[model samples]
Target: MEVLGHRGSRVPGPENTVEAVDAALRAGADGVEIDVRRSADGDLVCVHDARLSRPAGRAIVRQPTEALRARGIPLLDEILDVWAGRGRLICEIKNQPGQPDFDAPRERTARALAERLRARGWTGPRPTVADLDAGAGGITVSSFDWFAIEAL
Candidate 1:
């Protein structure tokens, strides 16, 4: 069985950060899972909470991507850079109701994810070994929001 690290082994570093992902991989994890959210500017960021207490209780959806990144929050692209092609990457989209950045019928978050993957040259239901060998990471997108999944 493949051993995937949840939140990239939060024990070693802050959850959802690049450091945590590296730590998990060093510890022999077969893959890593991370949470994804959309910033106010529509950039995908790696964060689990809708509101960040560490960043002065600011709402992630209201904060710009650069602002969050400056405060030590890694962007989704950063996490992907560290984990992609090394092993499996599971990105869980955070699009729950009551949270900021929740798009009802539009599924903007999901659509954005699809576009990002497409930009990265992901075109199949799943990446084949050849794709992985060609430096495309094996990725899985998941979300609690059914609409987001449907959109993906």
Candidate 2:
């Protein structure tokens, strides 16, 4: 059986946050499914809702990485840096329900993801960049929006 964490067992930590990812790894899960979103600066963030303030009451949309870093919520890169080679990160892209622009967010999300993979050299050697042109790798790209899927 594939032992995947349910939003990193949300009861123990914030759903889709790095704390949850760590909790899942400690719990011996073989894989983790994380929701991805494009932050204000076009960087990828591991979060479910478009607005981070929804649950924590902290407005995070359109905030740059440095400002977000001070909030303690790790970015996509920070999370992967810790567990990139330990197990699998099932990245599920989130639908941008309300946004100023559409295509920009999607492309930014993709590029941010690609950058993460490239940073750790996982794009060429490992499970990252799985959705490129056959485009095969280890990453999994999924979404409820048909437009997003078609974009990939």
Candidate 3:
């Protein structure tokens, strides 16, 4: 039913990059699946790994979102822009499983991205952001960490 376009990218380019996601959408994908994480400054980006350096090469672990944007990695807004009318989306929030950054304010990251998508509305037959009780659509909060879910 849902032929999800995995990550817009997995390993080829930057996972979840707008370019990667746009490629999938153009190839007849019904929706996009992407990973999200908070940057050092608590900004959300479409990064799959726990740290950008691991997949990105080098050891720039705690780079700010703006730095990643400058490198053209892609912020949430960029990803959405590329995937607009193409299809649905499965936003998987990255939990930074092994390497924990206690300093990262993940809750704020989630709420921020959630609010952004909510403002966008679905612009579709069943927009994910439309028809919600509050501006809480487009965001499906789920994680192994119960505390995290509760935080959202």
Cα lDDT tens digits, model 1, 1-152, are 67888999877679999999999988988788999998989999998999988647788988988889987889888987888667888889888988877886798888988998889876577777777556555888999899998998
For model 1, the run of ten residues with the poorest summed lDDT: 128-137
Top-down lDDT ranking: 1, 2, 3
Better of 2 and 3 by TM-score: 2
TM-score of each: 0.88, 0.71, 0.70
In model 2, what are the clashing residue pairs, if there are any? 40-62, 127-138, 130-137
Task: Give lDDT: candidate 3, residue 95.
Answer: 62
Ranking of all predicted structures according to TM-score, beginning with the best and ending with the worst = 1, 2, 3
- Report model 1's TM-score to 2 decimal places: 0.88
lDDT per residue (tens digit) for residues 1-152 in model 3: 55667787543455678878877767766667887777777667877666555355532237877787776667777787777656567777666445554323446555665677668864234444443323222434445555455555
Model 2 Cα lDDT, one tens digit per residue, 60-129: 5566767766666568877776566555567776665554324443465655666776777765534434
Q: How many residue pairs clash (N, CA or C atoms closer than 3 angstroms) in each of the candidate models, in the order given? A: 0, 3, 1
- Global lDDT for candidate 3? 0.63
lDDT pick, better of 1 and 2: 1
Q: Candidate 3 clash total?
A: 1
- Model 3 poorest 10 in a row by lDDT: 131-140
